[model samples]
Target: MNKKLIICALITFISLPNLADDETTLSGAELINNNCARCHNSRPVREFSISEWRVIMPHMREKAHLTGSEVKAILEFMEIASSPAQPVEVTLAKSLTVNPRDVLTRYGCQGCHQVQGAGGTLGPSLDNVISEKGRAFFLRKVKEPQFNNSSSAMPQMPITDDELEALAEFLSSI
Candidate 1:
């Protein structure tokens, strides 16, 4: 009986798509097609962040019989796919845990400040700042606008210190 059970178990394990010899580095679309499509139809992968996916993947993993490697590959694929596609801001090889342009858009910087010779006329254009000034100047201006210029009309942004640094870095590149 034990011999029979072992043979059956091996057969079942071999049948599972999550077996070690199966495809390991699946892309986001491939993962969805193979694992997620087993139960539900296509759903928007961009609807959730990687963190939210982390919270939700466990429930689906058990249901789908996904291995740990499969779950990790899928999560990475989704994170990269959902990230804003910008040459300077992102590359698929690097996980997009920190996208500066996303932060800039979130803070509505382009509403007033201009970059690359295009933006609202409300604030001064930042196109020349990188060439004329430096990163230090850019950082100070973003973190504490009034410090850079006492007569500056730009308001001090409510962004966190890291966000301010990222914004400064992005602007400096522009």
Candidate 2:
């Protein structure tokens, strides 16, 4: 009985962090959908490039009086929403190894995204996105960001399958 209690407690503790992350992600999406649209027709994420978003977010953040987390969330959603789809490369290595953080930085993800509370405010936080959205979702988003949302402005990244897998795994662990 003591063992069972310990296991249950462990599970609960482990689960709470993920649950919090999911809530934050959802709230960010909801806030953008509900609030941004109230003032203006919610533009598709594809409406602006990442650089353009950089300029626009600060002004909008001040105007809306959005908190840091809210700004982070909005930026996160926008990064994914604005990415354009690209054809997957056929010449990738069978098991190309990669460092996810390095890849992210190399791709300038930090310019628009916040990971572990560090990065830009142009996109949503990537702290627990894999757990919240799943690896498949990240795979699709990385390869073809506009697959589900035609209006996505997220730029297509030229990454291999192995890199994608590494990134998904890294994000899941986060």
Candidate 3:
């Protein structure tokens, strides 16, 4: 009777389905594709400042209706992706030098400032900033963002001199 009981117990245990460790966490790419890709491109696998990523990811998540875990996984994957030290390639896709058009879109400057017939209207028009302000004025305005309009709703832009020069040249060319 003991042997039979032991045999029955073993059979019951063997027939039971696994209850633990059945599921694995999703990969970042998978999470992004499943959630974010529906609305926007999975954030460019480029070196994004933590603030930049943080600023953008929430919007993407909100649009996609993704859960917190899904957002976290996608961000983790983006952080692991090998991107350039600077946003050089993304800025230089059109040419070796900066493309003003590209810069406007990449930084979402278009969302606020108007370029040569493009971009948003929340801020002043930059249609002729290249010609009107010139390089010196442009530099000052960009550097001292609060000089002209202390109450300007625009956020202080943080970019390097090289990027500034490239952007200026591109704008001037346009």
Cα RMSDs, all models? 16.7, 22.1, 22.5
Deviating ranges (above 4 Å) for candidate 2 = 1-96
Please provide, for model 1 over 1-174, each residue's C-alpha lDDT reduced to its tens digit, 9 standing for 90 to 100: 556556766766654444233343355457779879777777777788778999998778888888877788788767766776433221221213346777767878778877776567788777777668777787777778898579987877778766766666676666
Query: What would the C-alpha RMSD of candidate 1 be, to one decimal place?
Result: 16.7
- Candidate 2 TM-score over all chains jointly: 0.43
lDDT of each: 0.70, 0.74, 0.66
Query: Residue 120 error for model 1, in Å?
Result: 1.0
Query: Could you tell which candidate, 1 or 2, scores higher by lDDT?
Result: 2
Worst 10 residues of 1 by lDDT: 87-96
Whole-model lDDT, model 2: 0.74
Question: Could you tell me which residue pairs clash in candidate 3?
Answer: none
Which digits, one per residue and each the tens of the lDDT, describe model 3 over residues 1-174?
556556766666655433243222236677766766676665566646755777788877777777777777666656545433332112223245455566666667889888777779887777678698777888788767778888867666776666777788777777
Q: Estimate the TM-score for candidate 3.
A: 0.43
lDDT (10s digit) by residue, model 2, range 1-65: 55655676666565443434566667767878877778877677777887887688778887788
